[model samples]
Target: MSAARWQRLVDDLAAAGVESSVLDKPYTESVYGCVHHGVSRSITMLHPVSGIISISDRQWSKNPDVWVGWQVFREGRDSIVIRTWPITKKRSDVVAHVLEAFNTEDRT
Candidate 1:
């Protein structure tokens, strides 16, 4: 996925009031590592790994399998990538429940 696409995904998540983070910084560096890294590819390759969802910690982490649709590939770099999992209805449901906690509109 290109940086533009990645930004769009982030924007969608943000608009939906879903909280997301880079988890890795210097976006290019992180993208490079993910594409070339071993476990990183393995973890991200599978689409929407699960159907049933559960909450743990504060971050909304999900199985990549169930939502795996697109992986963000950095432009002009073969070794760079930013992965994005498709938003499933199931995932959206979960996001809605927790969105109040993150949604700007929900805040007073």
Candidate 2:
């Protein structure tokens, strides 16, 4: 994705109250989504091809990447990427993990 589109995604996430930003410089990215989970203290990014959020990038830290959740890319299946797709259509998927975290926290 171009810088403009990436900016829009970051803006959208901000609007929804999710802290997010694009990587720059040596960690430059064509398309990136680093979502930080407060409870786990982890960050997961959306896959460029399948849209499935991968485990936390080791390059960023030791946080583990997610394999499967509400959205994930696997061999036979295609993933729904929130950043590249329409905002309204993918809103739920975009916030799935956040919501899950809250719900789990409440029950604990």
Q: Would you estimate the TM-scores of all the predictions? A: 0.26, 0.31
Native-to-model Cα distance after best TM-score fit, residue 87 in candidate 2, in Å: 14
Model 2 is weakest, by summed lDDT over 10 consecutive residues, at 67-76
> What tens-digit string does per-residue lDDT give for candidate 1 at 30-107?
432564221211011111222111222121346322333332211111222222223333434434543432222211
Q: In lDDT terms, which candidate is top?
A: 2
Indicate the TM-score of model 2: 0.31
Identify the runs in model 2 with alpha carbons over 4 angstroms from their true place: 25-92, 96-108
Across 2-108, the per-residue lDDT of candidate 2 in tens digits comes to 34544555566577666666554233233248544322222244333332342121222342343222222112124332322112224355455433332331111
For each candidate in the order shown, give its overall lDDT on alpha carbons: 0.31, 0.36
